[model samples]
Target: MASSGTPSLLQRVSGSMVVFLGLLSVLTSVRCDEQVPVIMWTSEGISLPRQPPPTAGHIVGHQQLASYLEKALNIGPRNVVLFLQDKMSIEDFTMYGGAFGNKQDGVFPNLEEALQSSSSSLVLPAVSWPASNAVIGQLQDQLETSPLYMDPETLSQLRLNASSPALLVFRLPYGTGSDLLSAKEILSGNDEVIGQVMSIMKSQSVPYTAIYTGLQPSRKEAASLSVEAGLGGGRSLLQARGTHRDRWRDRERQQRVKEKPGVYPPVEFKEDDRTCMLLWAKGLTVSILRNNRWEEHDLTPSTFGEGVSPKLHGSNCDKSKGRLVLNYENVLGHRSFKLIFVMSERHYKVSARRWFTLDAVELEYDGTKARFNGSRNIYAPAEYSYRCKSVTSFRWPLLIPRSSKDPANQWRVSFDDFQIQGFNLKGSEFSYASDCAGFFSPGIWMGLLTSLLMVLVLTYGLHMIMQLLTMDRFDDPKGPGISVPQTE
Candidate 1:
């Protein structure tokens, strides 16, 4: 009985183990999810009151504030203005303002003194309201030109104020994650929020300055009064603006992709048209030898804008003369690269085919042009019966002459899955015969011989069977008087 129950007991033990492991994994995943939310600063804050203070003039968002600082403070090219919102906790202040006091004490007595002593060079400044419309208009104009430009609807929603804007400035080094390191220095401070904000700024490569407001609830009525005499705000307005700009750039890129030529139907060209020849490839790729390996660059309409053109002035449809030239301003960091295809008609039996002979491939680097002229041919059927959907591919190597300078290196170019259509065709669509070898392969010949041999073997086997005759023996013991009659 013990032996019979051993397998069942082991099965239950294994099942229980799996269940425990699954529960443990679930708990671990939940803990990871909970840790994902960290303290981060953003541009979001309460809107300014509509009622203007006696000393206030015009209300503006952080963007306008940054612009005003740029002009008023004469901010250098390397310097930027970053803003922080008012009414932040002590920990938040310590993180942005830089490390001050021991963790055990946890008290900020003189914020101004601490800010001055901080590594980030924090400044507390009370910016008086600009009463001049010209100044306000100029600031607004600068905001419009910025990559983080706000829409007109949001601009109209901005309220006017008579109170001066309170600002806390951090004059830190202008490199990636410069301010984040200041926050990180404090062992007990929460640097996650600032880390997230700095990541956004660093990715966009945008310079920024921060304005941290130290406003309190008791001073809400007196909006124009400065907080703490010199204490700065703690929020990041540029972080949110950078995110918005990233989305805008994404939309523009998607629009450009939609407008690319090959995404839509091919343009039609008249048959026997002499003015323009319709010759296009789905893509043009150039391969360059780098670090003992080849690196490929695919040229698109965006990269080589309107650079693919055919030389049709001297091209004659009747004479089978055509030339395609591709000029790219930049390829693989080279100054320029030019590829020319000299095309003509080749007659095979009763059919004529369009053929492109590679004339010259040149690469311009450091003001010197390296030209490679090779005898390579690409051909397709000339008749329109071959549909444009059919594509032909060609790949070849351009070996540098051994006698010439760089005999050790060889350059290769591959033209893959492209069509050369509209030579003397009715439409710009490419037409080509499918690449196929006629029924003369060695495999086909072998199959035919094998089938013939099997048929001959079967015929001989049947002939031999027909030649054999069976002997008949008659029993004459019982029936003595049996007479056999034979008929011819």
Candidate 2:
């Protein structure tokens, strides 16, 4: 007989291990891109190092903020793809900085420097300084162009992942009022950044964002920006911090309290009188205490006047606690101004100023309970079994103005302003308990039928195979069966 020549079990196992490692090396050897594509635009000529009179440290710099964003978004080091606007050339910009340098890192200068050693600055348009409109328009144009608009590697990853591009504009306004580039200038110019961005979002279907970073909240400007973002189905983040002194004090107190034992702050919002409502032309102001802090929400025009009828935007029920957390906001408004945010009363301070929580009105019917935040007459439909908690703040005295000089009065209430909750009166009407739903379509039915048919066919095929295997191939062993019976 021929000698057995097969390899031993150990040799076979070693071969398979080598093959697996070789395949893994081939799979992982290719360079995979992990960078996030970020098109950045910052206002030029604004002294990033300038110090404010009241604040000890300088205002937060754009470059520093950008660095924080990179870390927040998980962008890889040395892999942040940047866009050089205003005809910036690589020679004019630096990926590195030093002592004599501009004290800015990860920044690109739009204009070329006269001397390689001298400081570089961004080139502005002839029309004005920090023309946000022009920058945004040019960005839109670049996005429409070829993939060369971004780093080659980053573009490859974008194509592979199939992600739409985004914009991040950082502004430290150089001028005041009309000269400043902001969302307020929407209709002022055809090519204005806000308008153009909104058009691009609608026409090209892209994401556009304007990040406002400052030391204080510019309420009016922030509101306008928020409106712009809402129209475009995007986002607006105001990263403004409180007064420097206040922030420092908060940090210190938090640390001290955490370090000390048996020394704790009191919860003040738990009191019944803590919750209060302030009526103003802007909207209804609801104040509540939470975690030793005063939190306020303004139910503005978009929610109450000339907007969608007040209704339950969404709700969450906890059967175990018999409690429901309802989210109320204008149909078209931003989420920041949720009319009702919490149920359990709490209080917190702002800059050492105490503010109380607005108490919720409770109502019970047929063993069902409901609580409404603030004193408002708006109620959810009874069909929803939403035993709405009525607002205790609404009273006859509030209707009569305290003084003629005062702008706000209870008489300001109207159908448009008063009705803010949804109520279903018709018992026959049906609605979704949750925001999501499912449906059975024709395609689904067709697929199910096809599957059943395939299963039946497979079962029949298996049965036929078994029957064939059991059948006698030649004359059966019946001839042998006869002899076996005699022996038995």
For 1-488, candidate 1 gives per-residue lDDT tens digits of: 01111232223433212212212222322321111111111121211112211111223333444443444333322222232222222233333332332433332222222222222221212222211111222222333211122222332343322132212122111111346553334422222333333344444443333333322211232223222111121233224324666467546644664687545232222222222234444555666678998787776453223332221111223346554444444567753244444555555565444543333334433222344553243344555322222222223333232224321133454443344442545433445543323456668999999999999999999999999988676667877766678875
lDDT of 1 at 477: 85
Q: Candidate 2 — number of clashing residue pairs?
A: 25
lDDT of 2 by residue, 78-127 (tens): 11122222211111112111112343431212111111111111111111
Best by TM-score: 1
Worst 10 residues of 2 by lDDT: 267-276
Candidate 2 overall lDDT versus native: 0.26
State TM-scores per candidate.
0.29, 0.17
TM-score of 1: 0.29
lDDT of every predicted structure (CA atoms) = 0.34, 0.26
Return the lDDT, model 1, position 425.
55
